[model samples]
Target: DLFVLPSYYENFGIAVAEAMSVGTPVVISDQVHIWNEIERSRSGWICSCTVESLTETLKEALHNRAEQLDRGKNAQIHAKENYSWNAIAQQMIKAYGEIQRANSKSANP
Candidate 1:
């Protein structure tokens, strides 16, 4: 399946990752914050948010099913490596630990 999200402004793109986790390739607008990651991972295609760009991107994705399937597999792999909840939780824990240490140091000084 091809998932397309044309957001005007996105701070983060959890939905795209979520779709990719299940082996669904995505087509998103450049406005998404994760566009670079998507492009780099070959998990999806990104285009301008204009109607013409969207249409063209959609056509490309649809016409190239084999390539898209490969991308979808890659997307699932990428999602497993990067976006899993366990991984995210670990990162958040590390950040919180750093913040706590900083706060403790500040309180002592």
Candidate 2:
């Protein structure tokens, strides 16, 4: 399935993430922060929030079945690598360990 998120302004655009998580190719506005990653990974198409841009991008996506499937595969891999719960939890654990180490040092000194 193709997912389109043409928001004028978005903080995180969790919907795009959700779409990518399930291997769906997306067409999102450049305002989404994750657009860069999507573009780099070829997981989706990124365009300005204008109707013309969205229309053209959607047309390109729909016309190319092979590209769409390839991009969908990339989307799933990218989401698993970058946004998986285990990966995020590991990052948080590392950050908290650093915070704890700094606190301990400050307290002891």
TM-score of each: 0.83, 0.87
* Model 1 stretches astray by more than 4 angstroms: 96-109
Q: Report backbone clashes per prediction.
A: 0, 0
**lDDT scores for all predictions?**
0.92, 0.90
By summed lDDT, the worst window of 10 consecutive residues in model 2 runs over 9-18
Report the lDDT tens digits of candidate 1 across residue range 4-100.
8988888888899899999998899999999999999999999997999999998888998799999999899989888999878988999999999
Off by over 4 Å in 2: 100-109
Residue pairs in candidate 2 whose N, alpha carbon or C atoms collide under 3 angstroms:
none
The deviation in Å at residue 11 for candidate 2 is: 1.1
Best by lDDT: 1
- Tens-digit lDDT track of model 2 for 6-106: 98888888788788889998899999888899999999999898989999999999999999999999998988888889878988999999999999999
Q: Estimate candidate 2's alpha-carbon lDDT, on a 0 to 1 scale.
A: 0.90
Model 2 lDDT, residue 48, Cα: 98
